[model samples]
Target: MAGRLLLIWRLLVRDLRRHRTETLLLLLAITAATATLTLGLTLHELVARPYEQTRAATAGPDLVVQAGQPGPHSLDALAPLTTLPGVTNHSGPYPLAFLALTAGDTTARVVVEGRDGTPAAVDRPAVTDGTWIRPGGVVVERTFADALGVHVGDTVSVAGHPLGVTGFAVTAARPAYPRAGWHLPGSILTEGGGLVWVERGDIATLAGEQPLSYTVNLRLADPQAGAAVIDPSGGDARFRGWRFSTGQEIADTNGRLNAPAQQALMIGSWLLTALAVVGVAGIVAGRAIGQRRRVGLLKAVGAGPAMIAAVHLAEYLVIALAAAGTGLAVGWLAAPPLFRPTAGLLGSVGMHPPPLRMVAAATALALTIAVAATLAPVLRAAATDTTHALADAAVPPRRRRWVISLSRRLPIALLIGVRINARRPRRAWLVTVNTLITTTALAAALMALAQERSPVDLGYSKLPDARDERTTQAMILVVCVVCFLALLNTVVSTWTAVLSTRHPLAVTRVLGATPAQAGVGLAVAQLLPAIPGVAAGLLLGILTFFAGDDNQHAPASWMLTAGLGVPLAVVALTAIPAVAAARRPVADTLQAGVR
Candidate 1:
């Protein structure tokens, strides 16, 4: 006569212990979500801090001015801006060039920040690799060295002039156009980053030829120096203008400039969040199904619906909280790279830890997504009639006359598919939604790549060198990989769900349906819902381009491939798993599903 609440708690705890695999998966899901949010919030800070420290110790300037023509006028033009009300100090008239350099067996690119002085602290590069740039030597960006697998003592040639990499150093400046965007600049641009520090006297000889291509850099005394100049056009005409950067400004700017990388961070965050939703919910639903029959016995004993719902929902709450906390802790440790961009960018403006609000927001978002995704299945179980729920071992659908009639008239596989789909509409919807997310992500990534390579609004290609192109391409490859994995997981999850209906499937197999017929039936069950899902996903991929983006137009080939390819790939992936699962003995399957 005692209440079932205690029984429910005991049962829930027992299930948690018994399902170690499910619990681990739940932990992984939450961990990924937590890591992504933490990374998104903290990347700039992590990347920018060391650079800021280096910048402060050295005389790194605040603003960089680049000109199409390196001439006296460029220098003359900067003279007045330094005299602006808030403007204080200045550093260059430094000549910078981005060139593809070949060093022995390795062919790569180097960014040359040609200066007229020794490496300093206020505006200097701290020589970490070797000595500072002497009359004949150059300093390399440490990351660039890490990429090329070169060392401080190695030699790198730019435009035929081979110079020893005197030292590996960190600077206080970085361009959005090159590598080091906290945004995942893909692998190519992200790699091969080099800075050749040429002596003031050797500029002409090192450059191959230079009247000095036009560039002026300024170092502002205050943080607010060129704040108003972000818009670009409103500044003085003769000055074509230089943009001033602060340590914090560097981090924020890096985020904005690296579109693909930032998108990656954002997508990764949302993706993990979505996966956690599906993963946690699946485990919840599976448990709820088991609990449903027992709850029916309780309902017959006059147990209240509210109590039933609370008991089931409470188990999820505990799991979710544990997941959230564990995930946050993992993210806290794993996400420093995401918060700060590249070293140089960070040093231009100091990086700071985000306020407590970001952490609070991350927790809230994870909880909401997890709780909402699980509630539907739990609520459905709670609402079912006690007798109907308890009597059937494998619950039948309410009604699917349309599916039954169409199946009766169709090919064996098609008919089987239609019926299977109708039997479990939720699974079908899940497959469609998962497919949509992958395709949309791929589409968005492809479009991002196109933007980086072309940057239409700015006309000139974002990077004019092979190294830059390579970095962007690397990012695309990751997009492709991520999409493939998400799609693959969906196929696996679908197969697992289908195996839960072995009894019904066994009946079909026993009804003179050949093994091939049974297989087709299984395939159809997956494909019927997939057709719409793929079509819709393709539409979403295209629409996403025109959505909030620059109204960019993609070649039809990309759209078709992304849209159609995703669904087909998913369907194809399911084939092997479905076949393997379906091939098991009909008797065993029937017995298990009924149990």
Candidate 2:
């Protein structure tokens, strides 16, 4: 058994070294799929890490209670909760003043909270730059400050009063910037804005006649008991006009913001995996045709079918494993940036080893794509009779009276292209599927772009909703990758067709067909199947992504462009390889075919 294993290993190494380009193509196909799969599976965890760090560093409260309506007595209404059951520690019924803030040329609605000069026991904002809030100075939430381009020493007008920026800080008491506005009393539907802090003494003066809301941060004996602690059903009148949020709830909210990006990635990963299957299947099929003689030689030397199959599969299995590892590393390193922490959170998320489950899933996908694509072709090659394989005779092309009659009146290029496609119908279909996947992905990206109405209003300037921006980005990435893989598949299929038909094409050349005709025939073969593919792809893209959302349909002009453009691109991609193969010296090709 050990000797047999060694023999098989040697055979695999020699084969891989001999066919370096094919091996590299297989690796590229599987690695692309696995990397995208890894990103889809692990992005949520990656995005959550920074928020967790922020929560821990700030000693974030288990529950935050906010008054529903701003009034002088809001603090009194919230005071009773400080000593409530299960409360271990508490931070003030801090005064919250909703006001417009203007810094530089930007103006935004902000929730200005009044904080003591000293840090509280719970929900303390960690100063990242400069000092904490002082008597006439204000501190801006780190993300908010970054958005406003305000640093320490800059003055921001709050409700028409100018106060010098004292510091920039982050806190877990509120969801990150743009989301913090959700906590405002009586403003649950308000668009996300920013948060800032001022000395407690400055609140009354800055607010003037504006009613003030209050919030209390509580540390519960059981952090998870927050929901239970807050009376629901309005059974207690004291709980009326108030809202309660648990730390877990806050974390979930922040995490939910990444759902769009995650959805795009997950969907794109599957699309890419499908393309990998199609691309690898074509490569394997072509390689099988080229390897018949080798299979015959092994059989003549007494190699059994199982040994033959194992030798073939081992090469791909090794490549697949290597691809999986490469993909996992790339996915891990790439994820943090795609689902990066919003500026609102403290600490940065860096690349870390993916979880075991994610690694397993990615590896499984790569191996599955390899096995599924290669198995049938390899098995067929293994089962061929030794004499037939050794002879390496090409199968005779099937003739039909209707096909001959139809081609008689057609142009030389179209006639040859039709016959060529008829000879290798399976490769033609793979090319079709390749075009379909690319078109579908491109259409989906266009739909995503068309659906955006406007950026979220962030006071001073509009910013794209993080979710929309990330989703669009993910879609664009998927489209680009799918297009790249499709282009590769086109080139491979066209070249393989060119090689398979060289003898017949050379005969046609001798019969007065020009090299350009032969080349255009090859391109035409790919384009014939692509017409239906592009149409199906447009329909699929619409059904999959725009079915329920009437507003998400891409403009008719864009759809028309994609429909016409893809086949043209297919023609362009196939032309290079087709022309190169067609222009090969006919005399040489014919002699090789005869030998």
Candidate 3:
């Protein structure tokens, strides 16, 4: 057992050093998968951690009740809330008013909160830079201030009042600038806007007859009980058009600020993983085919099937281990930016590594893909016959009666192309399946972007913000990454096919076939399977991502174009490398086996 292990180890090490490019390809494929998985798994925590930190730093409220109409009467409406059964403590009747702030060339819609210099028990915003609300100074939310490039001592005109930006602060009571509040309950009442903290006496200057909402922050014994604790029927002096939100709901809403975008990214990661599987499998098969002579020689030397298989499998195992570590590091670093869109609400998005469970799962998943991809090819190599391995002759092309009879009437290039595909039907099918998976992901991403772009009549006015744009960007990023890897896979597969058929192609050139025909033949082999693959991908994409969203409409024309275009595009991409390989001197190619 020790002797056999030593043999396998030596063989694996020698082959890895010799086939450096192939080894690197294997490493990159798995690394991409693991990195994507790590990012997807840690996305929630990426947002959750910052939220918790900010919530802890500032005594964020459990519930917020806002009266739509402003005045002393509005304050009176919320005074009865302290007597509620579950209410423990409360803050406000703070004055909330929406007004525009202008600084130089920039004009920002901002929600100004009137606060006293005294600190409160609930929703106490922690000062990040400079001091809290002072007599003649205004404090800006950290993210909002960062966006406008406003610093301490900078003056900004708020409702035509030039207030000094005395400080920067962060709070858990409200979302950062541009996502003032949630969309469902009181979206209009609190339209997306930046937040500002000002002295209570400054409220009149900013208000200037502009509408105001009197907001009260409530701390309940049971934060989860929420609006249910409030008896609407009972004459508790409830204000007309009052909106109430629970602490738990606020936390969840804050946590999921970028939920749609994160979900899209996670879905994209899984798609990339699928592509990695197909790509790795194709690469392994190519490697096995290329090393057929080596496999036969091993068998002739009296190596057992199990021993030979281990040598081949061990190469990927070593690479997989290295790739898992690289991928984990890359993903850990890449995840912080993904949560930046919600950084305003969360305060400081920390670079916390993905949980250990997630890392383990990602590593396991990558290793599984590596093993699965190589299994079939390794088995084929192990099962090679000693006599055939020593001889190293190419497989005889199967005679096709229909093809031969019909080819006389067709162009030489097209006929040759058709013949090449017929010779290796299985390989052609595998390439086709890969194309299908790639195009399906592309189609789904496009569909998602289309949905995000199209206007949805949700029976209310929607706030203009970065949330939708961020989601679209996430989908686009995924599409780009997937397409790039798929492109690389296509090139590699084409090059491998060219290498395998070099002898046969050289013989054909000697029999009056031109370089162009050989190249076309090579491209044709990949394109034939692509037709059905593209069609299947389109259908699958529509069924998978387009079915659930009622607000989205399908772009039948675009899907059709994509299905047709992708196969032709593959042919174009494959042609250059195919032609280059075909143009190699026939003598040198024929003598390659002898060397």
Judged by TM-score, which candidate is best? 2
Please give, for residues 111-177, the per-residue lDDT of candidate 3 as tens digits. Answer: 7889989998888988878999887789998877766778899999887888998899888887666
RMSD of each: 7.5, 2.6, 4.7
User: Which prediction has more favorable TM-score, 2 or 3?
Assistant: 2
Q: Write the per-residue lDDT of candidate 2 for residues 355-423, one digit (tens) a residue.
A: 788888989999999999899988998889999999988878888888889988999999988898787
Residue-level lDDT of model 1, residues 156-239, one tens digit each, is: 777678777777776666633334321111111233234556776766675564445444546656555454543246565543
Best by lDDT: 2
Root mean square deviation (Cα) for candidate 3:
4.7
TM per candidate comes to: 0.69, 0.92, 0.81
Q: Residue 282 error for model 1, in Å?
A: 4.2
lDDT (C-alpha) at residue 332 in model 2 = 73
C-alpha positional error of residue 523 in candidate 3 after TM-score superposition, expressed in Å: 2.8
**Candidate rank order under lDDT:** 2, 3, 1
